[model samples]
Every structure is written in structure tokens, then in C-alpha cells.
Target chain A: MATLKDVAAKSGVTVTTVSRVLNNRGYISEETRDKVYLAMKELNYQPNEIARSLSKQKSNNIGIIVPHIEHPYFARLIGYLEREAVKKNYKIILCNSHAKFEKEIDYLEMFQSHRVAGIILCSRSVDIGKFVSLNIPVVSIERPVDVGTTSVECDNYQGGILAAKHLIARGCRHLVHFSGIENEAMPADARSKGFIKVCEDNNILHKEVESKADDYLNMEYHSLIESVLKENPEVDGIFASSDLIAAQVIQVARKMNIQVPDQLKIVGFDDVSIASLVSPTITTIHQPIKEMAQEAINCLIKCTEDSVVPSRIQLPVSLIKRETT
Target chain B: MATLKDVAAKSGVTVTTVSRVLNNRGYISEETRDKVYLAMKELNYQPNEIARSLSKQKSNNIGIIVPHIEHPYFARLIGYLEREAVKKNYKIILCNSHAKFEKEIDYLEMFQSHRVAGIILCSRSVDIGKFVSLNIPVVSIERPVDVGTTSVECDNYQGGILAAKHLIARGCRHLVHFSGIENEAMPADARSKGFIKVCEDNNILHKEVESKADDYLNMEYHSLIESVLKENPEVDGIFASSDLIAAQVIQVARKMNIQVPDQLKIVGFDDVSIASLVSPTITTIHQPIKEMAQEAINCLIKCTEDSVVPSRIQLPVSLIKRETT
Candidate 1:
């Protein structure tokens, strides 16, 4: 294998000059840089990136921790993140925290040891103090953090308002909102707040139901949704916090002999692939997933350089009308 | 920010001894190791993994390249791989090739530069010779490679037989098979061979339709499948190569007012989450994704320790009967 010494000898330059050219540490003349490049090309020398990272005290890798990779929402988010990271010449180190606090702590420690350039946290079980003490740049997605970390999310509250208004405009008198796990303190909780505000302002009848952590983890809400539908036969509209839950609502409605968009109307959030793949093709609030991913990467990079990035950024959301509504 | 020197001073040992203890490179007495551990704990020392990896000439990162991270099959596979990798104290460096030749080459070069312990290739666009010459241990999943690389795949041929027999046993005479793109040379192509042989033995009227590359990449097979159904109105049974395609078949059938399992019976492959999540729940062949992921990681780790390893490993598949059949 070709070494740095070989490239230096071939280029007729000192090893320090070659090292400086490789690291871009000190200014080098154009002629010297061109000569070094030509020598490196000729010798086919591949610099050891680990050694370079050790000297520079940083790696071009970003640690990404997600609660569940198999979930469509996170899966799509990760895909967009990978695409944007490649554009910025960064790689992703993936960790599945499974929504467990201990696993999140373990992964945070691992990231510290590896000296990753930054972290993107999609899970929200860990304490904010742990991330603050790590002293590494972090960007949380859809999870609000304290002063030390930056966050990027969609307009969840606005999304809820849109869903409620759409259902009302479609002549739905009785509405129901299926929310995420209770007391999780996620930014998504604002969704129900927005929905309730719109319902109260319109003087409409509405109810809010919270899904349990087990239902979220297992991705099974059939029984819960079925019970809700049976108890509220007059309910004509539902706004689910996620597309997965919305798909289940459609399934449960079907089993109960309720026709969608005729007897019952539905609107889902996140606008993931399942929203369209389902039978009724659910109407949904389109969260700017790709944009949020790009913003998270950009924020982490900015924090690495300046440490003065905006602490919170909320992008706009829109309603995508499909067959269901 | 305690350094090696600080730990050595606190433990009353040489810096070299502390380094050896950290890397587990050389023999050290239990008492001396215990003293070093106590010193590290008291000083709150964290070893820089980059420096340790440089000294060892290898990293604890396993490079995983997949064609599409948002696809449910690959997404589920990655989730399982991450879980298994964690058990072995390894981390995953994720790359999405998007089924592009240039992207695969770029990621391969980057993995080489980073000195990843091994690579798991889920994309098959790159030349096999590139992997052979890199002198790195590689394991290809569901993608067959020539000599100098290990491969892990489910029994695709057997899966095909199971799908065919299940459809036939359900009293379907006229059948149609929707295959992947033509001339891709993926190990999955064996599915068609098995299906064809079974059809020939039974002398059942059957037709095979090939999906274009765009359909697979975009995950939009509605038009293609609808056209096939229109042309082959006598086709009473259908077997799709992937759960995604099968879901599209159901959607197309519904649009055409054709009742599933009453007028048409269907069987899908891969049995990913999408299979069960879709309406009516697809009956399909299960690929044993978790076991395959474990085997792939184990094969890569074995290759790192010893150059000799099983060139190819084929795990078993099964039939998962559901409402579709």
C-alpha cells in the first residue's frame, strides 16, 4: 500500500508539507498542492481517515438515534436524512433506542466516545441534562429540548387546526381526535390542543382519546379504535395523530359496516406512504419531512462551526386531500 | 477530558501500561487491571475511540448499504440488523445507494477510507471485482456475489414453491405471476424459476408479467398491474414477488370492482409489515428476515477473524396464510 511518506518522496516535498496539504491546515502554494495531488494520484495513496480524525478531533459521521426504524414515519425521515447528509459529505451512524431511556443513555455515551461531529435525536426519552453535558452539537427532530440543543419540527398545532376545519367544512357534526401516548411531552401533543380549540370555537361536539405506549410500540390500534367507534356511533369525523392510526381507523370502520367519506370522514397526520396505500386513501396533513431532515442536518453543521444556531425552527404544513375526505 | 497520562499518574503506572489496558492488546495482571479501572473511574476518563481504532487498524463500525431505506422490507431488515449488531458491540454506518451504480462506488470508497471492520452490501449495482480487490471482508444480503465475498439470502426458490402450492391448493386454475425488473440478476429471480417449474408440473395455465424498473423504484405498480388484470380476465390467482406489489394489486382490483379471494386469490412474497397492514391482510411467504440479518452479521464478523468462511448461506422460508388466500 502507498503511504504518506511515499507520496512526499514522489512529490519531492517534505512529509510535513504533504501532511499540511492533506489536512488543509496551513496555506500551501498552488504549485505545491498540485504536485502533491499528482503524486497522490500516481501512487494511489488512501489516507487513513481514523488517524486523520484523531488528529483533527472530529469525524465526518453524525449519530442518529431513532425510536423505531421499522415505523413508516421514521423510515421515511431516515431516508431523507441520508440523502441530505450525502449532499453535505456526512455519514450517519444509526441507533435504535426502542424508546427506552437506558438505551438512549448508552448510545449517547457511545457517541461521545466516538467523537461524532454531531447528533440528531429522534427519540425523546432521555433527559435534556445528558445532552447538555455531552458538549456535542445536537439537533432534535419533533422533540423540543432545552437551551443547549437545537430543534426542527413541523407546525403540529397548525396541522390540527387544518384537520378540524376540513372535517367541519365537510359537514361533520361529531368529531373525535385520536392522540399519541399520554404524558409523553412530545411536540405532537400540541396537535390535540389545536384541534380542541377549533372544535370549541365552532360549538361542535368532540372527544379526545389517547393511545397507550404499548399500542404505539406494537403499531396495533384495531381493538381500541373499534371500541371507540362502537361507543360513538354518531361520530362522523376523526383526526388521528399518525397515518398508522388513521389506517387502523379505516380498517375498524370497515369491519363495523361503516362507509368512509359517506357515513364517516377521516383526516390523518404525517402523510406517510400508508396514508395513500390504504383502501380509502386517507386525507392527511403533509408534514415537511424532507425539509425538516435537511434543516436538522444544516443546524447541526452550523452548531459545529459557530455554536449560535437558532434554537427552534418550525416549518409550515399543508393539507393533502385524497379519496377519504 | 482526562487523558491517558492522567490515568497512568493516578494509577501509579506507565502510560504504555495504561494504553495496553485500554486496548486489551497485551497481557496484564488482574490486580494491575483493577487498579487501572479504579483510576479511570475516579478520574472519569473516556478513551477516544478514534485513536484506539487507529492503533488497532480497524473500527467497530459496520458499513451497511441498502438500495432504499424507505422501502418496508429493507427498513425492517435494517431494524433487525441494528439489534443484532448491538449485541456484538458494533455500530452501523448507514448508506442509501438508491440503486445507483455511482452511489454504490462512492460509498464503497468511503467505507475503505474509514477502515470499517466489514461491509454489508444490500445493493448490487457495483462490480464484484471492486469488492475482491479492496481486501475487506464483505457480506452481500439477498444479492449474490462471486468469489472473495460471502452471501446470505433466504430460500427464494422454496418461497416461490410455497406460494405456488398455496395458491393451487386454494382451487385456482388460472394464475399470473408479477416479477421484479427484467435482467437485474438478483438472487430473487430464482422465485420465477421455482414458480414456473411448479406450474409446468401441474400443467396449470399460467402467465408471467415483468414489472419495469421505474415501477419498482417509484413503488407505483397500479397502472401496470391494472393493465395486466384487464388483459388476463381469466386469471383467477396472482402471486406477487413483493408485498408492496401485492398491495398495489389489491388496490387495483378494488378500483376495478373485483372482489378479492372471491373472484381472485392472491399470494405475495417477503411478508413484510405491509403485507399484514394492508386491507384484507395478504397471505404470503415469510422470508425469515431477522434470522437472515443475524446470519449476515455473524458471517461478516467471522470473515474478519478468519479469511475462510462459508461462501453462501441460504435460510429457510415459510408460508404465512392470511385473508388473501
Candidate 2:
């Protein structure tokens, strides 16, 4: 933690001058004020009020980073987090990293300089090795960061297994799974593992269509689904990792004149609003968003109190059967 | 804004004690520290760093109040605003008022004491007369506060006209519109105005179902759509005030075995992602989200330079014809 003395020394100003600038009690030139503020920022000189809380070893503010606020899951997650934080007398400062590693770094630096008490990260940053250097308590949400910090994640592997089992129960032997490309940093690809394992155990033939990250648009999914359906004309069941992808699959399936549930049975994951709003009301896996948010906040608060938090917190996921299956 | 003197007075402590506590120097009892922090919060004393920016007449921080981040429109709008704010080296502290008047008041007070450079409001607060007393510049987004404040809103009235005209052009004789209940503070009800006026001028028999504000679940919408259809099964065209409402209408209509675009044509407002994701992709009025966010930021920045800003800015909305109409 930097102090006023450090700022004064770095800016080559007297302690009295720095105090006057901070208090706004005396006349100061624009250049001098700019120099003081810049030096303070450079040295991470937290203001007296927040600094008091910082000295107490925590702040009443928690920083949260999510990939994109527009995503339904993240939006709802943040809403729940804010409500929980308010109940705990904490403020939430949101950072949308947009799945970019550099922006993630920028927000982390900002959080460091501002001295937020903790962080709840649902970031998609692949290069998060630098996170270990962060001094603040951290709680991971969905995305696993490092070895020490606790993470609140839905049972993606179990969710994937349910999807596979449901499709099989629907009497679809030739199945396909839409999986995102594997990332070492994020353990969400466990969905792929569960799906593949189940298919192998059942001696069922399955195809996997992998997608790159940050592919919000269905262009890649559209092309991939088109090619997969073209090559494997016998494919009858499709399990998509996300409802958005499932909706797109239905769109492409409709365009290709494939009657859903009759010739093709589909199941999706993350029973967000889009799952029900889409036509045929996708049968999907329901990740408890509100419960997960509460658990994440509780984990961070535990870290604040005892500095010892769990390594992982896995919530249960259930299959929501709608019209698709 | 409350000064340190006010906090000391409120806490019934000496000025030196408060200063020492703030600076985190010298011995201070835990109870005394609690008293000081509480007094500062009660008096609304901003931290020195933000207060310094207040004294300098501008800040690199901006306060934003929106109804809720979970709303797709607001989530995407916030995403764009944050990107633009980052480009301009400004930080956004988001306040999700969640359609609560008290929370909106709380955020406004926080902004006032913290001395943000400006405010970009998409709040649902009806009584905004107190905003005139806000010293900082303000830019209203989506919802207009009052006179003498600049606002960014889509041409909702024109959107209604476009939808009505398109439905008529598609050979619809009878029509029905699902509208949000009229709000004096929010001018969004103009969508219904345009729809009704065009229908009256053309002497078309039309019905309307209105939902109350903050009624997100669409229970009112479901019952209203049901009754409206039962009374007027001859309704050949329908227009919903928003894409979310339109999507709900589609869901309920599907349950009733009403084939979209064949028995009933539908048009939605605010072409959010849900419009395209749903089966029978909604034909909606596309509100230029990114451009509007940029314009809102521009308006706030302009207010910082010159004290005066325009009363309202209405961006154009284009109808996106998909499978529905």
C-alpha cells in the first residue's frame, strides 16, 4: 500500500503541498495537481477514506469480472451477486473483460490500484497465470483460475452426462455433440469429457463439432452443423453445450427441412430464458444461477473473515425437459 | 457533499480524531473507527481522491443508473457504453436500480457525494424533479428525466408506425397491439401512440392489451393475450411494444395453436438477439444500440464542455423483416 509520503516523494513535492492538493484548501497550479494525481496513481496511493478500510485488511467493495454482461447467464449472475453484496454491506464494481486477456489484465490492475476487498471472476482469460500475484482475496465463478482459490461451478460434467442419457432415452442411437474447443485455463470442457465417456460406455456412435471461443455469432456453428449433418445423414440426436447453440441448431435444422424430435431429438445446456423462449422450448440442463452467486459471495466473505476458503464448490445441475426431446 | 468536519461533528469526535482515523495513523479503538466510518457514510462524505476530482470541476469517473443489467437491451447498451467510456479514459460505476425508487435515490446520493463527472441514466424512476438539483452534468439514456436534460431515445413512435404499416401492407384487416402501460416519466409509450393513431386514421378495427411496469414474468401478458385472442380471433396482425413481449406472445400463441404469419402476423420492438433467436425470427424495429450508446456518451461529454445540452435525441429505428411478418 502506497502513502501520501510516497506520492510526495515521487512527485518531488513537500508533504504539506500534497496534503493541500488532497484537501483542496490552498491554491495549486494545474500542472502541480496533475503531477500529484499522476504520482499518486502511479504509486497506488489509496485515498484516506478507502485507505482506512484497506488498512483494516479489506474493503467494503468487491470487484467482479465476467466475460460479457450481455450473456443471459452472466447478467443474471451479476444481478444476484449485487443483491447479495448489498445485503452484506458491500458494493460491487463490475468489469466486463469481453473475453480478452489484455482487458482482463487492465481490470485486474485497476482493481489492484483501487484496492477492492476481493474479486469474483467468471473471466474467459486463457492466460491467467499472473493472477497469483494478486494480493486480494479471490473467488472464482464457473471458470477455474488457479489451484488455491475456491471456485463455484455447476456440475458441467454431470450436466453433459444427463444430456447424453436423455438423448439416448429418447431412442436416438446416432448422436452428435456440439462442444467448444478445449481450453486449459477453463475447466468447462469437462462437458466434452462426460459426453464422450457416456457415448463410449454405451457403444453409441457420436460426432463432436468443436467451436472456437468468442464465437458469439452462430456463423461457425451454422457451418459446422451444416457440414456435420451433411456427412452424417443418420445423426438423429444432438446435444448442444449451450441453449444459444441449440437454438441455432434448430434454426439450421428448420432451414434444412429436418423435423425436430420426429427425425431429430435435441437437448441443450444452461436453461436460461432463451431455452424456453425459443420454438419447441428446448429440453436443457438447468444450472442454478442464483444459488451459485450466493455461494460465490459466501466464499469470498469467508476468505475475508478466515483467509481460508475451499478449493472448489460444485453446485448440482438438473435436466429440464421441454418440448425438444 | 459532507466534509470531514461534518463527519467529526456527527460522530461526536474531535476533528483530529477523525483525521487520524481517516489517515490510519496513531492508535484508534475499533468502536471509534466504526463510528467514524458510519458518520462519514451518514453524512455522505466522499473519499478524498474522488472529492479532489470534484473540486477540480470534473472527474474521470461517470455514474450510470439502469433499470437492471439482466435486461438484454440494457446489458448490451452497457457493454457499448463501457467500451466507449474506456476509449475516452473514463470509468463507469454501474448502479442497477432494479426499478426501485429508493435504490435510485441511494445511487444518486452516492454519485453526488462521490462527485462523478456526469450521469447516464436509463432509470425507471418516475419522479425525477430532484435531479434538477444534481450539480453534475447528466445524459438521459432511453428514459428522459425532465426538462433541460439531454436524452437519447429510439424513435419508438416511428417504430410503431412502421410496424402498423407493414402489417397493413401485408394485407392484415384486423389488428391488436400489446403495449406497456403508459408512463409519464418514460416516453416509451409513444410506440403505442403511433400504433393507435395510424389505426384510427385508417379506420381499422384494432385492440390493445397493456401490461404494467416492472411486470417481467409476462403473467399479465399471458392472460391478456389469451382474452384478447378469445374475443377477437379475427385479429390478423399483432404488434408488441418490445421484443421480449413479442416473444412471449409467440409462446402463448403457439400453445393456443395459432400459426404465426399464417393466421396472425406479429411485429416486435427493440430487435435484441432474442428476436433472431426465436423460432419464426421476429420482424422488429432495430434500435441502433451501439450508435445510441456512443451518442449518449457524446452528449454527456458535451455537457461537460458546455453547460447546455439538447433536450432529446431520437435515433432512427429500422424494421427487420424475418419469418414472422
Candidate 3:
């Protein structure tokens, strides 16, 4: 039941002085140090584990920043990261940016203040310069930063190509690709690029629908798909950027009386659980989420051990054929 | 670019003494303190935030424990809790219990060592006594603890009754209620209690299928539902404890050639995003997840301020009738 204040009062010193003795910090004279120790013994004070990391100028905690854990992609990734961190007796300090620029900045500053051993960022609106200046080991997931910064991502371009090829193989003449909101320079932009390149090479007609950045949590995918379908009524196939968007496409198509596979074949990316949960079992490009998450942690561990780290680690993606295609 | 060691070396004192000066902890002679301060100013050392919290014996952080963040229900709840915690400038240290008892205890001990201001437990396999003994203010979500413990949960009994009433109102004669795994002492058992009471009140034929607690994350709903349906082919109604279960029922029913709403009516609890995402749109009891999360945070803050929190705060649940019912 004894507290730091109780020990302070018993030892004839300020709580700060007692804390200093307990932390083995500050210029505590041998006499004062002995007195503080006697008071702690008499009070049965438990000097907590926090002081170990503080004196060492490091911690066994990894700061993980994501857009939101509620998103399936992020949740699954966090699960894997947690698995790895737990193995090393490292705790996770999780921050949800909630797609806000200010929040991400605040978290970055907080992580720095906490002196977390490392940080894994899946930020959407971060200032790259501020992040690079932190001087902590960082392994970004999906979102690639500048050179010398490590990042782990799936082969998004190959995913796009596989999607396009699958849809085309299913005898689709016209195509529409839904790209979730992205930075002009993000690696995910590569998904649409590959789709466009493949379509262009084959001389197949296609169009790309880019979602606004803010459209993720409050997705207007239904309206977006509805309008695109109305405008491109002749479109026979869709290569959606994500499975959730593809599921939305399926819903809109159902309402529009456009039969999947029979009349409007569709392929989705990121074969998340929802891909199979949906009735038609979405045909998707499966990006090895668990593998990518492991790679990110591995890269972070390597960086944490030293500044040397591979700039990029991209995993392969494969196609999962289902009823939708 | 200067390190703590550098500052200590320049100040002609041990790093512990310099750290003590930086943390304002322990006794330091005026001259020694001034020397450490001058060295810090020279090195431009940024006194980290972690040490400030350590000296204060408190932190602006909450430890959040859940069965698994990848589970939709937990993910959504965590998202709402994160939003509330961030508003108070408190960081969240997240842990997924992964349905393990030891992991829950390990996390609890870790949270104690870190001296978190509070904890919000959505644990499935925790010892209530162990949690209560930590002397930390805790707000348990869904899983109720002993009397005088703070907790926030939906009106589960009402949720069950609503499901039963909806099914009966839709002219369902032969009924079945799927009860998720529950400890006999848990308040969530009230859900099945209400369901059975409603069915008995209506003189309707019904059976309860209890799911094992271990079957949650790796759900065996498909095989379980298949056997139940095979044995009770005339079952025309179902009140599932969670939307995931109801989704499973829909999938099973489809394969069994049973038509939703036309031949069988189903109602589910915890109207998570998946309730609407699934085709046939599950009719579910909406548990007001966001409001519940806010209430949990409010209760924790109250308890942390002055151990005077209410024992229990229950939110209302409503039926969202979609295509399934």
C-alpha cells in the first residue's frame, strides 16, 4: 500500500528525491541514498520496472502507427507484428492516425518522447522530413518513404497485372479499375499503373476510377461504382484495388441486376477475410499480409540492431480464383 | 546528435547523476546540478517524455486488452476507444489476448510495470481477482467482473429478447438460438436466458445450441450449424448471439438450399460492419459500440480521478432489420 509519496515522507525527502534514488539517477550522497533505501524497505516500496529502460536510454516497446486498426488490412498486419514483438518481450504502443495529418505528427513526437526502441509507420498524411529527422529505426508498411528509409510492401504492380490478366482471360473486352485513394507517388499507385500498362499493351479499352483520400473509412464506393457503371455501361470487367471495394461493386451490381461472372466478371485485390465472406467469394490478388508483416518486423529488428537496412522489401502476390471471376 | 553518455562525460559525472538532474529526481548539490544543466544546454539534450512520466509515477496512457483486434467486433470497439483516449491526450498500449489466459496475465503484469493510468479489458480468459488486485483503475467491457468493479456493456438480455421477438413476429414457428461460448457466471448468459424466456412465453418450439468458448476466433459455426440443421430440418428461426454467427448461418443455409426471410428468418447480435457487408444483410441487435466505448473511457477516467465509478453502465441495443429478417 506504500506509494512514492509515502516513501518520500518517511525518508525526509521530496518524492522526486526518492524517485531519483530508486532510479539510480542523480547525485545522491551515500548517506542520503542509504536513508532512502531504508525508508523503501520499511515501507515495502516496489521500485517499478520502468526505471530499467529509462536509465538505459532505450525501451522494449515498439511504437506502431496505422491509419486505423478497425480496418481489416491494418488489424491483420498489427496482429502479425504483435506476434513478432511479443516473442522478443517487446510491448506495442499503438496509435491510430485516423487519417489525420496533425494526429500523425503528434504521435511521431510522442513516440520520440517515449524513446520507443523503434517505430513501424503505416501513416497516410505524415510529413516525410519530420519522420526522417526522428533518427529512430523505422520500418514503414506499405507506404514507402524516401531513400535510406526501410519499407515493406507486396508486389502491387504484379498484383495489378495478375488482376488484369485474370479478368481478360475470362473474356472481358472492356474494363474498369477502382484505385483506392493514394498519393501520386505511393507504391499502391503501381497497382493502377500495371493495370493500365497491361490494358494498353493488349489494346483493351479500360478506365481508372481514383477514390479521394478521405474516402477510406467513409467509403463512397457504392456511389462511385454506381456512377462509373452508369457511365461505362458497356464495361464487362472490374479490377478493384481492394476487396472491400470489390464487395461494394458486387452489391451495386446486384442492385443494378448485373450478374457477376455471367455478365460482369470482377477481380479484387487484397484477399482479406471479407473476400471469402461475401457470397460470390471474390476473386482477388492475394498479397501475403502475414509475410509482409514479418518482413517489416525483421527489417525493423535489423535496423534497431544497426543503421544498416534494406531500403525496400517487396513480397510477391498471387491470384485466388473464385466465383466472382 | 549528442547522447546521454556524452552529456554525462562533459558534466564530469556519472550518467545516473545527469539523468537525475534531467528528471529532477534525487538530491544533487547546487554546483553539480548547475554543471549537469550547463552540459545539457551545451549538448542541446532533449529531455525525453518517458522520464517525466516515470518521475511523476503516472502516465497519460491506457492499456487496452482484447481477445484479438482482427476480430471485427473487437476492432470496432478498439477504434472507438482509441478515438476517446486520443481526445484526452492519452496514448493506448494495445494487446491482443489471443484468447489465452497466460497472455492476459503477462499483459496485466506488463501494464502494471509500465504504470498505466488505467486499463480497459475485453479479455475472454482473465482471472477477475488478478485484475482487481493490480490496484489499477480498470473498466471491463462486456465481460463483467465482481460487484463494485467498473464495466460497460450493452443490454444483452434486451438484445436477446429483441432477436426472439423479431423472429416470432415474422411468423417463425420452429426456433433455434445460438449462444456464443459463455462462462456460466458471465452476464452475457442473460442473452440466452431472455431468448428462451421469450420462446417459452410464446409457447414456441425452440432449442439452444451452445458454442464452446474456444471456437470463437477459429469458428466452427459451419459444421455445427450443418449438424443442427440436419437434425432439425424443420427449424424456421434462429437468434444468433453475434453477427458473425448469423453470417455463418446464412452461408450454411444457402448451401443447404434454405432461403433467408422466405423460408427461415435469422436475427443476430452485435451489428458490426459485417452485418451489413454480408449479402442478405443480417438483421442484428445494434449494441451502440461507439457509445459503449465512450462510456467505458468515461468510467475509467472517473475511477482514475477518484475510485468512485459506477459498478456498471449498460447501453441500449436496437434491432436493425435488413434483408435477412
- Tell me, by DockQ, which candidate is best: 1
lDDT (10s digit) by residue, model 3, range A236-292? 999998888888898899889999889999898888877877777789999899888
Clashing pairs in 2: none
TM-score ranking of the models: 1, 3, 2
| Candidate 1 Cα deviation (angstroms), residue A171 | 2.4
Q: Say which prediction, candidate 1 or candidate 2, comes out ahead on lDDT.
A: 1
Report the TM-score of candidate 1, chain A only: 0.95
Model 2 residue A152 lDDT score: 90
Alpha-carbon interface RMSD for all candidates, in angstroms = 1.0, 6.2, 1.8
**Residue B43, candidate 3: how far off, in angstroms?**
10
Can you write out model 3's per-residue Cα lDDT over B1-325, one digit (the tens) per residue? 5678999999999999988887688999999999988998897676676677787777778999998778888878988999899898788999988878898877887887788889998986356674566667888899886665688889999988888989999999999988867564444588988888899999999999887766777754788888999999999999888888888898888788899879989898888877887787889999999999999998888877885778889999999999898
Give the whole-model CA lDDT for all candidates, comma-separated: 0.90, 0.79, 0.84
- In model 2, the Cα lDDT at residue A212 comes to 73
Quote model 1's TM-score.
Answer: 0.95
Model 1, position B187: C-alpha lDDT score: 58
lDDT of 2 at B86: 78
By DockQ, the candidates rank as 1, 3, 2
TM-score of predicted chain A against the true chain A, for each candidate: 0.95, 0.79, 0.84
How does candidate 3 fare on TM-score?
0.86
Judged by whole-model lDDT over C-alpha atoms, candidate 3 comes out at: 0.84
